[model samples]
Target chain A: MNWIVNNGDLIGQLVVAHLATAIPPIILSFFLSIPIGWFANRFQVSRGILLTVFALLYAIPSLPLFIVLPLIIGTGLRDPINVVIALTIYGIALMARSTADGLASVDPDVRQAATAVGYSARSSFWRVELPLAGPVLLAGIRVVAVSTISLTTVGAVLGIDSLGALFTDGYQRNIPSEILTGIVVTIALALAVDFLIVRIGRLLMPWSRIVGAGGGRSARRQRTAATA
Target chain B: MNFLIQAFAFIFDPKHYGTANGIEVRLGQHLLISFEVLVIAALIAIPVGYLIGHTGRGRAFAIGFSGGVRALPTLGFMILIALGVGIGLGAPIVALVVLAIPSILAGAYSGFEAVDRRTVDSARAMGMNELQIVAKVEVPLGLPLLIGGLRAASLQVIATATLADYVGGGGLGRFIFAGVQTQDYPQMLAGSILVIFLAIASEILFSIIQRLVVPAGVTAGRPKDVRVKSSRSRAALG
Candidate 1:
């Protein structure tokens, strides 16, 4: 309590830094994934290739990626941009797969119906396909948001600023409260962001609330679609 | 490209292998620690998961629990544990196992949940004991999801164990951390490449295991595409 109170301004600054590092990757990955995910979903061969590549990209550990990425992209070793770029890579890796899977979850007949109604490929994607995949995509984004917020801390060890600075500082200083503060704040931020995403999702796609609430109906519909 | 070539050279150099703190030794320690953590986590999680799946209780708790735990930052979690436990492999092991349990628990229970209720009921109607029913009916069918959980757990543990080195938990991560301190970019890149290889190998190995475990009769009539869809969806849930 004393540590937190005394260090209030420092903690505030850290939170701001954390948000700056985390949010861009979340938003960038969500938008960029749609096209990549759509491309993956559109072709049979490319789906396997793209998903595998992204999965492999994700398999690389964060610290190492932070270290090596600068060499590849010509950022300075300690540049905050390294964290942002690395996190965006991680975010896209997870979201692209989710995007592909979410898009895949949409029914084929629904696509045909949109075509019959004279919707072009581009407009149908924006209007019909993306909207229908909203729930699953929202689920994917929620995961990305939480994971990205947590991962931003990894940058602290590399000397990039974030809430994670507390962990290293606290550990070296032997102050357990500061470490606890970092952990608590990070988790709280993640859950709060997650809640906000859900709220936004509810506003954007009011229909999914009903489908999500009555999951049994959708499950049954999917079962019948499978049978048909 | 020059950096890449230097990293490969560093990896290929025979001087880095064998003996104390060699690449091979660090690699072995990394694998051993990951294996130990996975085993401990599985022992604790699988039985609880079984109970939940069998009794159809705690499903909501399990989901919420895993979700919250997943939000935890691994690096901070390790540092906190190391501070309490006073810095050793023990701290990281404890943290890693804590990190690993959620995925395995989800896997074990979800595997059982995936079994059709009608199938379990039929097995009961035919006078099979609960244990027999689980072993014969559920285990075989739920194997894929269980393995899926293990795959997720392994990937997570492997990635995280690298961070463990930050607190003096020895592994291949030593190279990356040590390289960072000395500004040795090639060495850092080399360590990253090795870890990536190990992770990808484990992924391929688990996938093969997943394919092999699918009961022949169960998957026989299903299209390959549907099989892929089911496995991927289960992954998305994780």
Candidate 2:
């Protein structure tokens, strides 16, 4: 109780820091990834190497990268730019994959038909392919957004205030309430973000409902069998 | 040749091994920790996923939650849990469990969902009990996806295990963390190289395991169904 009273301001500061660090990379990732993915889909040669690099970035440990970034750039927590850089690496990787998956899944005949109708290649991509691929692409975006939110907590370790600071403070002080608060808040934030994305996905792509609904039905059948 | 020898020497230096600190670098410890977490996560997630997926309620919720869980930066989760649970292996174990569950659950759910409805209906019409149908039909059908999920989860846990050192749990992470703290470039490089190598080795092993566990027929069987369903849904929408 005493800890919460004393540290309430700190908690607020931490939450603000987390959001600041997380949102930019997530938004930037979408911009960077979509074009790159479209290009990759159009050209087969570059896709493999680009994807491999992204995968490697994804595989690297977050802490080491966090520690290494300051060393590389000679910057400190006073600027959240370093965290943004590290988080963006993940964003690019996730979004790129999502873009590729979305574009690949589009019906080939649709592409042929658009070309037959005399649409330019670029116009066809923007007008035809991209719209059809929206749901899968957004699914990828939802993943990247949620992931970035969670990863932002690590920025707390580097002295940028955020929910992670709450965890660290609670741990250092041995205050269970503070720890619980951080955990609850972090999970709640993640859930809220995910829920919003899903809702938006449904709204933007009503056609996806049938596929989503079928996925649900089949999943239920699996559950009954597994339990039995 | 000199660089290679220097790297090897730095890697093998007894003083750098944390042995003086009573943390021996044993292959067995890594294997044990990785295997235990994988088994426990599978046990919990597979059944739960099967149930949730079978029930037809809130799949997006379950999958999204898992993705959210997976997205939680491992270091952050470890640090938080370490605070609650106190340092040592327990915190890392708990974190790994959380990390492993989502993939296993997603995999199980997707795997069973991918099973042929006609096959399931035929089994049911033939009067097989639910238990028998699941055991004989769904499990076989879902095995490949289930294995793929386990493979993914295993690789993730193994890589993330290095973060356990932050909570004072012994693993390869200790070397990596210590090298960072001390600014020992050679030590850091060596530790990272070893971690990466171990990760790759584990991934290869799991791939082989997946191949052995998931019959080739299952893989061949699924894509057609997935494509058909997706196309049908798209057509219905149009």
Candidate 3:
């Protein structure tokens, strides 16, 4: 308890640092995945290969990745950029898979209609296909967000100020209160971020509500409404 | 003969096999801890997921909640919880529960959502209550999806459980972490191999369960017929 009271500012610093390390990777992953997903969709390459590569990347434990990153970048303990790079590798894998899945799930007839209406491929993707695939893509985004939030902790062990610093400091000193403070703060952050993502998803994909209802009545109503 | 002797010697080494600081490093303990956490997470997650998937409001909540939960890093959560909870295995257990819940819920929800409405209606017309319908109709139909979710969750739990060793909780993670600390590449490789093997074994087991539990009727593509009958009944009811 005394430790937390004495070093409270450090806790805040850690939280900010963790966020700094996490956000960029997530944003970059979103951008990178867009093209990868489009490429996968346009070409008839084996999804099996794509998924396997992604899964392998996802499964590579964070600790080893963090260790490997510094060797490649030649930065020692001073910078958190390598941590971000390592974390982003995982994010790219996830986001790309999600992007591919979302695009694939887009209705074929909708694509056909867009092409029939003289919409170019780029416009159709941006305007029509992307909008319809919003729900699935958002679902993928949610997963990536959660994963990035979690992986940010690994950055702590590398001397980046974040929630993990609290855990490491508390562990090294055997200060239970300091550790507790960090844990509580981290969980709160996770929950808060998750809530925001859900809210955003709901706002972006209002049609999901009707789909959520999941019965013949809702389905029939949706079909009739669409035709009308 | 020299290579064979070295391998045997390494395998039988007391330092490799047992306690350095009064902690057991047996393979069984790791399996036990993982099994306990997986079974408990599944038992809780599957039923909750089923209920949520069956209802509209519940589905919304589950999807949102699960997404939120998945965003949390398991290692960080475990470390944090270990601090508050005062160390030992409890922290990792809680972390695993949190980690496993999202996949299980998502899996179960999707499974129920994908159920053929006609089959559900037939079960309903046959006078099955909600519980019966879920047990006899929804669950059987949703088995494959639910199994897939469980398989994914279990593998994740096993992999993440390696981190449990960080907080004095024993598992295969101890080998990996300790091996890294000492630069013992062989031990790290062995530990990773064991973890991967466990994950693959669990996947095979779940696949078998899925095969056994999914009803032959649903597997035969009877949902189309069931849908027609269900539509007629729903219209009549309306």
Candidate 4:
């Protein structure tokens, strides 16, 4: 652990860089996917095409995407933003599927009930549909958060700097401790972020917490199945 | 667009196709590593997953383990293993196998888990042995989901196998890494394209297999079910 102690400041900086690189894509993808997901859900005709495209997008390896993205977007080869943009694309691809599935999971009868109560399309969506879709959306976002956080390290290969920098540096220097630290920290950060998302979800959707508390195994199964 | 042309040119150049480090050779290496890792991981994981799914005995542990595995950074794993083992196929193979195991395990068991319990009960009612039931009932019913798991595992392995080059475990990733050092954007892009092509080819191959494997009567609902569950692996896709 002397490596960590001697490199405390460097570790701190890398952690910050990692978060900066990871969080934007997580947040951006979560918000952007909701609408795209809604469109897919709203227009049944487009659902298949949209999902297939996103799935293909996700299937592209991150390194190649990182290499080719600059060509498409004109970022410099080593630009940190290239990593961010590529990750956002992946996050959207993933979250869009989740969002569409989340939005689709809403009960039609409940939506009709909201309409009968005089909620407009927009109002009902924000109020009735979005809230009802919260559990699945939350699950989707959690996955996005974890995966994006883990993926931010790929930027290190390109010399863009992040927690992943430790990996390359450690490998070059033959410092296993540093690589271990990066792996542990990355996983910790992901799980911690996931925990924070869950906490925030509980706070924002108090009713879900209540259902979670009372609904027992069946509700839990339904949630898993929804995301499934 | 210019780089795209350069990349295609790099890919098509006959001069780049045959030597020790040729695209074809690296591509073959890439596929070989991925195939070996997948086969080994499947051999290990599928049975454990099957037990978990069949008995419902370790579902929670399986989920927790896979979820945690998903959170791991592939680059970190590769670097660490390569350092530990002094750089060889052992490192990449070990790392990639670890990466492949979770999805396959998830698939094998979840495939069994997804089977209707009532069907198992009926099979039992018919005096079928556990092995016979699994073979005739659970395996047949769960083939699509099992295949879905394999497909996801294959994609992630193929994609990450590119990184195998990072640690001297050579693959198509050689082009990407070699190009990066020389600033040969075309080579890097070409490597990426080749990997993407492999991923897509496997995807199509699996989808067709997934379709063909479904027991005839259950075809209507199983494909869609498999599609939705395909989301499980994206968490580990990175």
Candidate 5:
């Protein structure tokens, strides 16, 4: 108790730093993935290669990625940039898949109708496709958001600032409370962000809500859509 | 680059491969922890998951539970437990098992859920009991997903198990952590390469098992586009 209280200011600073390290990559991936995903979906052959490569990247463990970043980027061991850049790479991999999956979920019939109604290919993507893909995209973002927050805690071992710092501090000092606090705070942050994103998704995709709330066969359909 | 050459050299050097502190022992330790945890997790998760899937109850609970399990930062949990448990094998093994149970549970239940209602009905019409239906119909059908959950759980456990060194448990992670401490980047890279290789190898192994076990009809009927693991992955509520 005294540890968290006495270190409240320190914890606050670490939380801010944690957010700083985690949030940008999500934003960056959200923008970058649109083109990346578009290109992947556009070229069916290349999609396999691109997706495989990113999934491979995703398979690389977090600590090793952190360790490897300095050698690749010429950053010092403690550079916050090391953590940021590594996480950004992960975020991109995650978001790109989501974007591709989201884009693919768009109904071809809908696209044909939009085209028949005088929408250009470019505008049709922005106007018809992107909006419709919002729910799954949001689902993907929620995943990236939660995992990224949790992963930033891993950054502490690399000496980048974050809630993970508390964990490291706790480990070194043998204070379980500090580590407990870090775990609690990080989990709470992730859950809150996930909830907020889901709410936003529900708000944006009111049709899902309408269909879900409707009677008969809708329940099964909703589950299929969810699991799909 | 010279780094890659050096790393490959370090990895292949005979000196790194034999003895208690060597790669062999480390790999064994790593696999041992991963294996034990996976066994433990399967025992717990599979039954609960199978029951839920069979009964068609607790769908919401299963979703939330899986998310909660995955959202836990494994490193944090391991280290926190290590503090109390004094950095022995106890902490890491428990932590890894905890990290593993969700996917297995989700995979098991979802697999059962995926069994067609009519298939079970016909079996019942033929006078087969519930146990017979599960053993004969659902098990055969759900085998692929059950394997998938195992595959997913194993991959996760194996990859993350390398972090065991951080908690003072022995594993392949020793190379990465030790190399970092000594500024031996090549050794660290080599450790990472081994980790990646292990993951890929296991993935291949699981894919083969999935192909072998899944009913021929299931594979022939469906394209490989379903998101059984990732979708059930539940945005992993932090």
Candidate 6:
């Protein structure tokens, strides 16, 4: 009660700042990792190593990355740039592995058929493989998006003025609502972004849903059985 | 060069070995917090996941809940609960339990869901009761997936529990927070290193458990029914 009315402006600023820090990495990593994913999937020699690297990167604790990023990238400890860079790297690590896995799952027959249909390698990938890979890739992206949203708040530890500032401020000021607002808003933002990505994936590949619906009960069962 | 030297010294200091501020004390805190959270999460999530997956009615709930939990920012959640519940270890444990539940739930239910329908049917024909069938058939078959979920959930608890420092719940994160405040990069690095070691060690520990628990047939090279399961805690080969 007192937290919101008195700190309404502060919450608003934090939300905006939080979104600002969170979005760039999500967008950047999507573009950045697709190529990296493709390269990993295409090359037989380095697939294992590449994936292992990403997995290790993914496993690195977020707090350390947040702390260590400034030293690696030559930014101030509290700089939002440090947060963004660290997050972008984390996002890339997450997205690249999924991208590789997605691309790897595309049917060889479908790929050959695409090539046989007078498509160049470039066109075949963009038109054929990429679309085929969308559902899995988008599924991975949903996790990453949700993950990034959650992780972005970790940056506030280093003094980035994101929604995490609310946590710090609330704790400092002894205000529960401020902290509550931060939690609700952060979850809402994550859900909204995840929903948007899912919708966009659906729009991008209407045929998948049609195929899924047409495939009948067991195929759908298998889909549900795949786990998160 | 300086970073390496200082970080090594920071980690290896003798006085810091068994003191209140020692890495061992913090690591113990880390393990205790993670263990409590993982136990609580498994109890709730595994049962719920098994029931829903066994019944096959709560797929939507399971899926939606998994996504929703991932989206929950831990720091805010921790602080929010801490403010409401008041500080101590309790708030961080509650927050970590929230963070850990989804994958565990997904794993438990999906394990049951993935069991062969024919096997269950054959067991029914053999005059086995529902309890007997689940206890005998489903439990063994679904153990791998359950272990996988436990694997992910445990690591998540270990990784995320570091945030406990923010809410005054001490762990390795204390070093991280303290180091940052005082510009003690070596201490910060040491803390982060210890955390990473624990996380990786836990990962290896669980995978080994999974290998031992999962049967030879299930873990064997059966590429049939390949599906992408990008659960938050997917295991990776190092």
CAPRI tier for the interface of model 2: incorrect
User: What TM value does model 2 have?
Assistant: 0.78
Please report the TM-score between candidate 6 and the true structure.
0.90
Segments in model 1 whose C-alpha atoms lie over 4 Å from true places: A214-216, A219-228, B220-238
Cα lDDT tens digits for candidate 3, A20-131: 8887887888888888788776755656566656766666556545644554576653378877887788888888877776777676888999999999999999988877
Candidate 5 lDDT for residue B5: 88
Docking class of predicted structure 5: medium
- Residue range with the least summed lDDT across 10 consecutive positions in model 2 chain A: A219-228
**Residue pairs with backbone overlap in model 5:** none
> Any runs in candidate 2 off by more than 4 Å, and if so which?
A43-53, A67-82, A116-118, A158-161, A191-228, B1-9, B14-28, B52-61, B64-85, B123-129, B179-189, B216-238
In the order shown, the candidates' DockQ scores are: 0.53, 0.23, 0.20, 0.64, 0.50, 0.56
Predicted structure with the largest lDDT when compared to the true one: 4
Model 1 agreement with the true structure over A134-221: per-residue lDDT tens digits? 7778878888999999999988877899999999999889999999999999999999999999999999999876775786544433
TM-score of the second chain, each candidate in turn, equals 0.91, 0.84, 0.81, 0.92, 0.91, 0.90
Q: What would the per-residue lDDT of candidate 6 be over residues A1-228, giving only the tens digit for each residue?
A: 766888788878888888888889888888888898898877776777776677667677788777667667667777888777777888888788778777877779999999898999999999999887777677677777888888888888778888888888878898777778888888888989988987898899898788777975323432533344
- Full candidate order by DockQ, most accurate first: 4, 6, 1, 5, 2, 3
Over the full model, what C-alpha lDDT does candidate 2 score relative to the true structure? 0.70
True contacts kept of each: 0.67, 0.21, 0.24, 0.77, 0.44, 0.67
What's the CA error at residue A228 for candidate 3, in Å?
28
User: Where is model 2 chain B poorest over a 10-residue stretch in terms of lDDT?
Assistant: B224-233
Show the colliding residue pairs in model 1.
none
Q: Report the C-alpha lDDT of model 2 over A114-227, residue by residue, as the tens digit.
A: 999998988999888887777767767777888788777766544566687776676667776787677667767777877887798789777667755777642332222222
In candidate 4, the residue pairs with backbone N, CA or C atoms under 3 Å apart (3 or more residues apart, or in different chains) clash, namely none
When only chain A is evaluated, what TM-score does every model earn? 0.94, 0.84, 0.85, 0.96, 0.91, 0.92
Candidate 5 or 1, higher DockQ? 1
In order, the Cα lDDT scores of the candidates are 0.85, 0.70, 0.69, 0.86, 0.80, 0.79
Q: TM-score, each model? A: 0.92, 0.78, 0.75, 0.95, 0.91, 0.90
lDDT ranking from best to worst?
A: 4, 1, 5, 6, 2, 3
DockQ of 2: 0.23
Query: Looking at model 5 chain B, which ten-residue stretch has the lowest summed lDDT?
Result: B229-238
